[model samples]
Target: MSKVTNLNQFRKQQARVKKREQGSVNAEKFGRSKAEKALQESRATKERRDLDGHQREHDE
Candidate 1:
């Protein structure tokens, strides 16, 4: 005897698997680690501070 499957459940399961596969592909292509993000943020902050430090103040 052959087993029958629930069509709606089977379709939902397949969609979940496809979504997971696409997520992994996108992550590998565009994702960055926590450390890399923090390092870049800190560098930007420091650059901004340095530029601000070089600006002149005017007094009346």
Candidate 2:
């Protein structure tokens, strides 16, 4: 006689693996590190400051 395994357990394990894969994909697509976000914000601030510095004051 051959050993019998629980089919429900196998299905649950398969579902868990699929969920784990989806979570990883979502994290990669939607996640950013703090340092990366900070760097982007820093660059944007610098650009804005430079643009403002170059603007001439106009009196109307």
lDDT of 2 by residue, 1-60 (tens): 999999999999999999999999999999999999999999999999999999999999
Q: What is candidate 1's CA lDDT for residue 11?
A: 98
Instruction: Please estimate how well model 2 matches the true structure, expressed as its whole-model Cα lDDT.
Output: 0.99
Clashing pairs in 1: none
Model 2 worst lDDT window (10 residues): 26-35
Error of 1 at 3 (Å): 1.3
lDDT per residue, candidate 1, 1-60, as tens digits? 999999999999999999999999999999999999999999999999999999999998
Local accuracy by lDDT, each model? 0.99, 0.99
Candidate 1 lDDT score relative to the true structure: 0.99
